[model samples]
Target: MKIFNVFPETIFSIGPVHITDTVITTWLVMIAIITISYFATRKLSVKPSFFQEIIEAVFEAIEVTIKDILPVEPWLVIPVLGTLWILIGFSNLAGLIPGLKTPTADLNTTFAFALISFSMTHVIGIATQGLKGYLMHYKEPTWLLLPFHLIAEVTRTIALAVRLFGNMLSGDMITIILLGIVGLLVPVPFSLLHIIIALIQAYIFGVLTLVFIAGGIRTKS
Candidate 1:
């Protein structure tokens, strides 16, 4: 029997471009993040509000995570990784709302994220170690390993996309099936568990991105 269709349905079109609910939800998520950030930072002062304290804690946590991973100061990479962690976590949890969908459940959305991480990994690598230095890492130990290194990069990016897509897709399907059988109240525990898993996946995705980039920055290993 068919469960959920992996592809999202087209909601509308503009000119020649067709937009899916996935895209719309993603835009909504982006707007929400931007609005919250604007409000959170606009009132900066000597003393922090309660909401500002929570926001500061989130940023501190991201910095600490990056510090634990990359030996560098964590300044350059913080913005990209922190955005990924925040946006992806909120996108995943969007499913908890009654009318909204989780944008990360869509393969296109996750694939786009993986590509961003992949591209930024190389960009930051080059910025840290210059182009020639970054490229030379592929030939480390011997030139014979370069091809294997290339293949690993491509495969890992694909795996990164597929992993998030599979987990969120399966979670959505499970919740739908349970809702069909047991109605609303019974699925509450599972729903909360799903939320926790979503946050975990978001953090894992950011950490994996850092790990991939860390290798590029340091050629020795």
Candidate 2:
């Protein structure tokens, strides 16, 4: 293992685009999600299996998170938010696998997520409130705040990306260092803690996305 390798190792090159280990891991995670989802819901009956119950509980939790942020139709946004949670949660937990790196530890993945949320915020804003009303949100309270609002929008997205990258990278690095120092078994507690933190970070990312979208949809009264 390459100890303390901050950058993702390039596995191969397709044309000019280099495919990294992180990308490979992300693809595996997506496939796993799809497989699990298909199997879990494939035999859905009125009497839910334990696995199906767990899946439903997760969806319920995500729905509650969305409803907490916006009173709007939570079902309409569940697919987006639910996918975000699954992707992020899986990415964050990838560190548990010996050879797999967490995609969330890479800026490319987090920034992509942030960019999607940023686009969704404005898109939903324009759809819910007319384009004119959506644009007017920047000038809420006073037009003087337009520049600040615009700057905040871009900066916050960057912040969101960096926040996930930094946290996941730091957590993984620490776990690796501890394991190296005292061996793997000694770091088991830290690994558990990392799992908790990873889930929390995923939840935060999803909630922030929902909140940003909600803000965009609500125009000045």
Candidate 3:
């Protein structure tokens, strides 16, 4: 009856070492991304095939979204945003597999992903507008407001990580509970709903990343 038992965990570890089901899943997710992307981009075609077409459509959509959000340099944002969308989108959908759990279902995994985005956001900001300019922006309107701006950034990153982790973990929990009570057939509707939730979470994460990056790149008036 304990659903948690199915998740593997290492008994003990040496210095700087920790292991868990989530770690295994994270590695799998990275490998999956590398494998898919390598093959997807391995051969460029003048006349695209089905896989290439799908990849192109996804990139095109990301490009358009970036253009809408950051008018000045859509090209600059495309690679980052596009890669995030694809990687997160694939990781989210990975839960649908019978034996695999989505990495997003684990708080550690989601937080790590969110932290990377958060760091990149600031790094991009500093790169776009030098350290002095970037730091000065927080004092805009009034120096007293700097603390509030800093708090907002931290709160936003925590919110992003928790939102994704909560949604995916809840979906997985719900599916397991329903399956226990009524077996697989009854869980079909819930699974379908989970699929929708997964896609939405990925889209939301991607859009938020785009917005943060765009804001960072914008100049103060």
lDDT of each: 0.87, 0.86, 0.76
**Cα lDDT tens digits for candidate 3, 1-221:** 12443344664567779777567666777798899889999998999999999989977887887778763567656777677777677777777776666777777777877887898777767776778877777777789997898898899899999999888877788778888888868767776787788888988997897778767566544
| Candidate with more favorable, higher lDDT: 1 or 3 | 1
TM-score of each: 0.94, 0.95, 0.88
Per-model C-alpha RMSD: 2.4, 1.4, 2.7
Model 3 misplaced stretches (Cα beyond 4 Å): 5-8, 11-15
Show how many residue pairs clash in every candidate, following the order shown.
Answer: 0, 0, 0
Clash pairs (backbone) in predicted model 2 = none
- Candidate 1: give the clashing pairs: none
The superposed Cα distance between candidate 1 and the true structure at residue 131, in angstroms, equals 0.7
lDDT of 1: 0.87
Query: Candidate 1 residues 1-221, lDDT tens each?
Result: 12346788788999899998788878888899999999999998779989989999999999998988885669889988899889999999877777667788899999999999999789888887788888888888889988898899999999999999889888988998888898777678998899899999999899999999888777744
